[model samples]
Target: METISKIELRNLQIEDYLELRASMIEAYSGIEDAPWKEHEIKKLLSIFPQGQLVVLADEKVVGCALSLIIDDKDIDDNHTYEEITGNYTFSTHNPSGDIMYGIDVFIHPKYRGLRLGRRLYDKRKELAEQLNIKAIMFAGRIPNYSKYAEEISPKQYIEKVRMKELFDPVLAFQLSNDFHVKKIMKNYLEGDTHSLDYAVLMEWNNIYYDKSPKLINSEKSIVRLGLIQWQMRPLKNLDALFEQAEFFIDAVSGYGSDFALFPELFTAPLMADYNHLNEADAIRELAKYTEPIYQKFQEFAISYNINIITGSMPNIIDGNLYNCGFLCKRDGSSEMYTKIHITPNEVAHWGMKGGDVIKTFDTDCGKIGIIICYDVEFPELSRLMADEGMQILFVPFLTDTQNGYTRVKSCAQARAIENECYVAIAGCVGNLPRVNNMDIQYAQAAVLTPSDFAFPNNGIKAEATPNTEMTLLVDVNIDLLKELHEHGSVRILKDRRTDLYEIKKK
Candidate 1:
C-alpha cells in the first residue's frame, strides 16, 4: 500500500535542483531525451518564479511542475519540444502572454500513487485563472506505448487507451484531468524512446479566464444598472423591509442587471420604531441595524448574482454616529464606503459626523466609487475617484424638496461629464411621517453619462419620473467611455492642465 505523508507545495528554489533532478532520474530513467538542468530550473525561476513549483515530503523534493507563458499564436501541434522551450533556452517565455504553457511535469517513482501530480495540475489551473491566461497547453508522452510498438500505431494505441482496452499512464492521467487532445505530433522529443518520438498535444481551457480581464483593468464593455428609487413608507418589521428589498433585487436580477442601487438611508423608515427618542438618539439607535442589514445584503448579492450598492445607513463607530454605504458583490465579497460629507440638517438634528476616508471600490463588473447625497455636490470627490480609475460613480440620496433634489441631480450630471464616466443616482421619494427627521422625500433616479456623440446628447441615459417610487434601468457602454477618453471632441480627463492647478488629498 502507498503510505500517507505530509507534503508542502511551493515555488521551486534553485537550491532544490539536485533533489528535483534525483526525482526526475528515478521517474524518467532509460529515456532517450535530456532532463531539465540546474541552469534551466534557475532560469525558469528567474523569469517566471510562480510557474516553477515543487512538492516536498518532509522537506525533500518529490515532484515538480515547470511552466512558462506564451502567445496563443505561438501554439502549434506540429512543433518540436525545443521550439516551445526556445531550444532549451526558454526564450519563448512571454511576460504578457495569453496561454500557460507547461514545459515539464514529473513526480518521483516512489511517490507515483500519491496523486501529487494532480495537485500540481490543479495549482497550474489556478495560476492560469489568476493571470487571466486563456488555457493550459502541453505535449504529453505515451510512456507505456513502447511495449506495443510493433503491434499498433501511436493513434491506434491512443484510441484503445481512450476505449479502456489499454492504459497509457501519462495519456490516461491527462484525460482524467479534463485535458483534451488537440493533435498528435511525431518527433516531438527525440529522446523519448518509449513514446517513439511521438507526443499528443493536450489543452485545458481556463473557464475563469477573462480574455479582456473581467476584473481589474479590463471591465465588462456593457453593464446593466438598476436604480431602486425607494419610497419612504411604513415598515411592518425589519423582515418585511428585507423582503421588499429582495423583491426589487430579484426583479432586477431577472432583468440581468449587473448592479442594483438603493437610496441613502432607505433604512430610515425603520427609524419609526425609535420615534420616542430625540432625532440624535433615534439615528444612533438606527446604527445598530448596520450589521444585520449589511450581512443580508451580502446574502442577497450572492443569491441573486448581482452587485448591490446598499445606499447609506446610520452607523456608529467609536461612539460616533456616521452614515455608511456598502458594496455587496455577487461573489460573497464586500467593501464599505463611508459618507464623506455631512449636511447641515444632519448635524443640527442628528449630530451626524462625516467620514474622512475616500477611495474607489473594485467590483466584478468594474471599478466604482460611492459619495452619498451631499458628497456628490463636491467636485473634488469625484475627480479623486476618477484619477484612481473609477469608471462608475454611485450617489444614494434623500431629499425632501425639489431644491435639494436639484442640487444632487445637477452636480451628479456634472460629475459624469467631468470625470468621463457613468453616474447613477437613487433616492427616497415619499412620506414617512412616523419616522422622525424623515417626514418627506423627493427624488428622480437617473443614470447619467458623459456628453459625447456615443452617448445621449442631454447626458441622461435613463431617468425615473419625478417624485415617484420606481426603478430606473439603464445600460451604459464602458467602451464608449474608453473611446471618449482618447477620441472624444472634449477630452476632459486628458486635457487637465495639472501643471498649473490640481486636486490632491492632503
Candidate 2:
C-alpha cells in the first residue's frame, strides 16, 4: 500500500492567494447560483493578507484555508459597514489581542480525500494559538440544496445527499477540531434562492467580554414567526413598499418575536412587465432602493433589535437576474437569498428557473431556513433544511388561485410534520399581473406548527385574509419543534428504515 505522508500548511503568499482564488471559483462550479468573483477575493485578501494558509502535497498547494484576522476598527470603518457607524467593530478594543475570523475553508477538488480540511484547520488552530488571539470566528455554509431524494422520512432527504457530498464530514471535522458553533448566519450568499447554506459561526475563546455566567442548565430556546402577504400597489413605488413594510413591521414588532417574515416580492414596485427587465438591472434598482430602506430598517432592528426577513425580489448577479430574499438584522448586517425553483411559467417565458441550493440562517429566534416562492415546491428543499437541524422555516411566496395557495399551505404543513419543524409562509394578496397580462392571485398566508398535520395535533392555528393586505403574528415555540423531533412516543424522524432506503438508491 502506498502511504500518504502528513502534509504541512504554510501561510499563503500573494501568488498563492491568486492561485487559491482560481481554485475557489473552480470548486464552486457545482453551485447553481453565483460563483466566487474576483472582487470578493480581492476584498478578503485585502482584509487579512496573511490569514490564508495552504496545505502542501508534493510541495504544491493542494488545499487552503481562506481566513482573515480582521481588525475590529478597520472592518468597522470599512465601506461595507458604512450603513451602521461603528457596527461590526468590537465595542471594547483589546489593545493586546485580536480576533481571528475564518472566511472560507476550501480544498482542491482533486485532492480532497486525504482529510485536507482537517489538516488545514489543525494548522489554523495552531496559528491562532501562536498569535495569542482571544477568539476565532468563521462563516460556514450548511448545504441545503444539495440533498437527494430518498424513500425514508423527509429528514434524511438532505442528510443523505450531504453525507455523500461530504458536507456533514466537513461540519463534523470542524466540530471535532473543537470549534463550537457560536451562531448560524442565515442566507449569506448572493443570488441563492433555496435554503442551501447555514452560516455556522464558530469560535475559540479569548479577550472578548463575557456578559453572562455559564449556566449548567440548558439554555431556553424561543421562536417567533411573522407572516405577511406581499400586497402590490401598482401605482405605489419603492417608497410605498418600504412604508408598508415599516407599518407592518411596527404593527407586529410588538409580538416580541425573535424572527419575522414578510411575503415574497415585498421590496419593490410590481409592474405588469417587471420580469421583462434585466433581472440584475431590476435588482440593482432594488438595491439602490434598499440602501436607504435597509439603513432605516437596520436602525429599526437596532432600535427594536428585531431580526426581520424582508421577502423576495429580482436580484441581479453577474448581469443575470434571480428571485432572491434578504434577511436583515437590526444590527445592520444583511444576508440575501434567491428563489431556487422557477415556476413553469417563469422558466418558459421569463427565462427563470430553479435556484442553486438550500441555505438556512441563524438569528436571535433560532436556526431558520428562508425559501422563496416556487422554491419551496420541492419537498427535497424543505427536507434538506430540516435535516440540518433547522427549527423553523420562513417561506415568502406569491401564489395565485386558492388551489396553488392551498397546495403551498399543505406543503408547508407537510414539511413541518415530516421534519417535525415549524413552517411559516407569507404570500401576496390581490392580483399581481406580469407585463404579459398574466395575473396570479393568492388566497391567504399562514403559519404552521410541526403538529399542524401530524396526529394528536390539529390544523393551522391562524391565517391572513385571502384578498387583503394583512399581517399575522404567530407565536412559535422553538423548543417544541426541537423536543418533538427528539425520541418520543410520537417520534417521527427517529424511527425509520434508513438502511433499507439505500437499496432503492442502487
Candidate 3:
C-alpha cells in the first residue's frame, strides 16, 4: 500500500457517479473478494443524498463510504422484520424509527496506506449527527482487513477465523465505526469461509434528529427478461413440418433460451377453403392432421428439456373452433391460451368471433404471456398483460404485408419498453400456396428491450431476419425487469392516467 497526502473529501454529485464507478471497477480489477458494482452504488445514492463520502487524491476519487439514515420512528412504526424462515415477523416494539445504517466503505487500492476508510466513516458519523438520526446499526464480514490482503486467500482466511464472511468491506468497516457484532448469518454462499461468512449486526444510538429527506436520483435497479421467438411451420405434411420444427427446437433448447416460441398454426396446415366445413369439421381435420405431430413435439421438448411455446393451431374444444397456443415445459406440464383477437377474415372463414380473455402464467424462466396474430394490434390487451406483471410477450402471426408486419413488430417493441419487459415476435415466413397467391412475410423474430425505446435506454435488444425461417436466441435476465418495474424508470405500469383512461372507457 502506497501513502499519499493530497486527499480531498466531498459528497457525490450526479456528474461524479459514472467517473467514480469506472474508478472503482478499475481499482478492484483483480480482486474478486472486493467486488463492487455500479448498481449497488446507485442504490446507495437513492437512499441517501450525501450517503456517499468520497476522498480525492489530487482531483479523483480514491475512496468511498456509504451510509443511509434509518429513522427509528420509521423503523419502530414498521411491524415486520426480515427473518430466517423466509417470512416477515414482528418481534418487539420500538420508541422511534430514527436510525442510520452504514452499508459499506471503499478505499482505492493505490491509497490503502492513508487510513482513508476510517476518515470516511468519521465523515459518515458526522453526517448522521447532521441528519439527527437517533441510532445507527450495521453489520460486517468477520476477519476484517486481514481477509482482503493479497497474501490471504478467502478460503485460507475462513480457516484462520474458523468462521465465514458475513459481509464485505462495507460490513467490516462498520465495526471500527462504533458498531458491534450482534448476530451471525451463516453459509450465505457456497465456497465461502464458514465462520466469517456470518454478518455481525451492530448498532449506535443518538447521533442526530429531525432532518428532512431530499430527492435522490440514483437507485439500484436492474431489468430482467425472458425471450422466446417461435420459428416453426404448421402443415398437413407431418414429416416436413415436424422436420422444420425439430430444427427450431434444437436452436432454442440447444441455447437454453428462456422460452422458445412457434408461429400460429405452427404444426398444422390451413384448409384450402373453409366454405363447406363447419367449425367442428375444420377442427377435427386439424386434430386428425396434428395429433401425431404434437406427440412428437412433446417428445422433442422432453429430450431437449426446455420451455416451448407451441404456437397457435386450430383446435376443437366442446365443438367450438379456436386458435390456441400451448405453453409446454420440460417437466411435461402444459397450458393453453385461446386467441382473444380474431381477424374479420378469420371469423368469416371459420365462423368464430374472438376468445374471451388474456392470460399470463408462471414458467421456469419467469412469468410469460402470449398474444396471437391480430391480438397484438390491440394495445389494451398488451397493457393489461403488462399490468399483470408479465415480463415477456410472445406473439405468433401470419401476415402478407410488409407494412402490417412492421407495424405489429414495432408495437411489440413499444409494449415491451413501456412495460419494462421483453417482447418477442415470431411470424410465418414461408409460402401458403393453398390460401392465395399471397407471399407471407413478417418480423419472423424480434427481441425488444426497454433500452430500445425512444425514452433514453428502452428499445429492441435483438431481431431476426425480416422474412426468414431462422431461429433467434437470446439470454433473458428476468430479475432486471422486476427492478425496472419497481423503480418506475420505464413507467409502463406507473405514470398512467387511469382516471382519464377510465373516462374514455365509459
- Number of clashing pairs per prediction, in order: 2, 26, 59
lDDT of each: 0.88, 0.60, 0.60
Candidate 2's residue-wise lDDT over 1-506, tens digit each?
A: 11232244677765655666566666666656323355554555555555667776555566677665555454331122112212333232233436676655777676665555765675666566556665676655555434532233324533443355434545555665677666545445543333353345556664323333232223435455667666765645656656777777766765655566777765545443356665434344554454465455654553344677877665556666567667886434678777877887665544554557567777655677888766666777776776677877888877768788877888888887777777788877765454332355665777777663232356475778777877787776666665577644476667656767411110
Across 1-506, the per-residue lDDT of candidate 1 in tens digits comes to 12332356789999998898888888788873446877888889999999998988657898899999999987776999889998999999999899889988998887776557877897788788778889999999998899998999888998999888999999999997889988889999887878888999999998877767755333357899999989888997889889989999988876879899999999988888999999999888888888999988877775566789999998898989889989987655788989888999999999989999989988767789899999998899999999999999999999999999999999999999999999999999889889877998889999999998999999999999998878888898888889999999999999999999999998
Residue-level lDDT tens digits of model 3 in 357-401: 676888655677888978888887877777676877888776768
After TM-score superposition, the amount by which residue 92's alpha carbon in candidate 3 deviates from its true location, in angstroms, is 43
**Model 2 off-target regions past 4 Å?**
1-218, 268-296, 432-440, 452-456, 502-506
Taking all chains together, the TM-score of candidate 1 against the true structure is 0.60
True-structure Cα RMSD, model 2? 20.6
Pick the winner on lDDT between candidates 1 and 2. 1
Candidate 3 displacement at residue 346 in angstroms: 0.5
User: Which is the leading candidate under TM-score?
Assistant: 1
- Cα error, residue 269 of model 3, in Å, equals 4.1
RMSD of 1: 11.6
